[model samples]
Each structure stands twice: as C-alpha cells, then as structure tokens.
Target: AQRVTQPEKLLSVFKGAPVELKCNYSYSGSPELFWYVQYSRQRLQLLLRHISRESIKGFTADLNKGETSFHLKKPFAQEEDSAMYYCALSASSGSARQLTFGSGTQLTVLP
Candidate 1:
C-alpha cells in the first residue's frame, strides 16, 4: 500500500517569513509525487511535481528518496500564498494508476 502523510493540519506564518510544510510517504516502488494547492475560493491546482524541477509561485519541494519525504518550502510567505496544500503519490498498481493523498495542510499567512 502507498500512503502519504502530512504531519501538520494547520500552519501559520507571518508575511515575509519562511515556510515549510512537512510531507512523508511510504511506497514499495518508485512513485510519482506532486503538490497540489487550493487558494481561497479557487479550485485546486497542481503546484509542483518531483519530476518537474520547477518552482511555481515561489514554492518548491525536493523529493528526498532516502527519507521518503517531499516537504514544500517558500523563502518568503505572503498573505496571498495562504492556501490548503496536499501531498499526493501516484503509482502503477496491477496495471492501473493509483493515487493516494495525504491529509491536507492549511497554511495561513498572516500579514
């Protein structure tokens, strides 16, 4: 079984401060990992992927295979960056793609 874990349910950060949202995963084989974010009143969208190696909206997450972690980070938090973030894992299971999501983390950037 594949599982994703987000340790914190909610994280509050001051504007201009650095932020990190913890995420961990367990899987038997190679897995595709992604971060999805939802802003207030906006639909959920893909933030970044472990394979993409791109930064979106000043947020980046590096997949650590050794620790089985993909923690999202931003150098400076902004009020506009406040949103709910989810860590998801996808892998082929018995000729079908299976996606497992972690409990989302709600980030609140206070100005």
Candidate 2:
C-alpha cells in the first residue's frame, strides 16, 4: 500500500519568512510524487513535481528517495502563498494509476 503523510495540519508564517512543509511517503516500488495547492476559491493546481526539477512561485521540493520524503520549501513566504497544500503519490495499481493524498496542510501567511 502507498501512503502519504503531512505531519502538520496547520502552519503559520510571517510574510517574508522562510517556510517548509513536511511530507513523507511509503511505497514498495518507485513512486511519483507531486505537490498540489489550492488557493482561497480557486481550483487545486499543481505546485511542483519531483520529476520536474523546477521551482514555482519560489517554492521547491526535492524527492529524497532514500528517506521516502518530499518536503516543500520556500525561501521567502508571501501572503498570497497561503493555501491548502497536499502531498500526493502516484503509483501503478494493477492496470490503473492510483493517487494517494495526504490529509492536507493549511498554510497561513501573516503580514
């Protein structure tokens, strides 16, 4: 079974402060990891993918295969960055692709 874990349910940070959201996963085989974010009233959108090796909105996440972790980080936090973040894992289940998501982490950026 594949599982995604986000240890924190809520994280508060001041504007311009650095922020990191923790995430871990458990899967037998190689897994595809992704970070998804949902703004106040917007639809959920892809933040970053481990395979992409790119950064978006100053946020970056590296997949640590040995540690089975994919923690999201941002050097500087912005109030606009506040949102509901989710860690997800995609793996093959039989003949179909299965995605397992963490409970979610609500980030609040205070000015």
Candidate 3:
C-alpha cells in the first residue's frame, strides 16, 4: 500500500519553539515526496519537495528512501507558519501533480 502517515494530528507551541511534522510512506515504485501547507483561509500550497532541497518559510524536508520517510522541520516555528500541513507522494504514471495525501497535521504557534 502506498500510503503517507502523519502521526501528529495537532501540534501547538510558542512562536519561537521548534517544529517538526513527521511523515512516513509506503510505496512499491519510486515515489516523489512533497509537503503542502494551508494557512488560515488560504489555499494549500507546496511547502517543499524532497527533490528541490529548498527551504521555504524556514521549513525543510528530507527524503529517506530506506526508511520511507520525509519529515518537515524548522528551527523555530512562526505564527504565520501555523497551518494545516500535509505530507504527500506522487507517481510518474499520472499527472505529476496527482498526489496521495495524509490526513494532515494542524500546527499552532502561540505568542
């Protein structure tokens, strides 16, 4: 089963606290991993991709093929970063954009 799992349903902390959004996956074929985030009433947007290796909004994700995991992390989570975070994986067969998503984790940053 190709699946993405986010263990934490919700995480809340102070504005300067570190944040980590765990993600795990199971897939038979080669997979591309990505993280998507939704802030307040905004649309879900791509936070980062394992392939990109770029950090967005102080967030970075590393893909571990052996462990089948891609976790999002930031040294200090910000209030604006508070949002719904989803771990996703996609295949080459369908649209590159067609991703299977996890339920998601809601991150709250308090002042």
TM-score of each: 0.94, 0.94, 0.93
lDDT of 1 by residue, 1-111 (tens): 889999999999999999999999999898888899999999988899888889999999999999999999999999999899999998863344657999999999999
How far residue 88's Cα lies from its native spot in candidate 2, in Å, is 0.2
Of 1 and 3, the candidate ahead on lDDT is: 1
Measured by lDDT, the strongest candidate is 2
Local error of candidate 3 at residue 86 (angstroms) = 0.5
User: Residue by residue across 1-111, what tens digits does model 2's lDDT show?
Assistant: 989999999999999999999999999998889899999999999898888889999999999999999999999999999999999999962344767999999999999
Report the Cα lDDT for residue 15, model 3: 91
Off by over 4 Å in 3: 93-97
Q: Encode model 3's per-residue lDDT on 1-111: one tens digit a residue.
A: 678999999999899999889999999998989999998999999888888789988898898999999999999978988899999999754455578999999999999
Each model's C-alpha lDDT?
0.92, 0.94, 0.90
Off by over 4 Å in 1: 93-96
**Model 1 alpha-carbon miss at residue 51, Å:** 0.3
TM-score of 1: 0.94
C-alpha lDDT of residue 24 in model 3 = 95
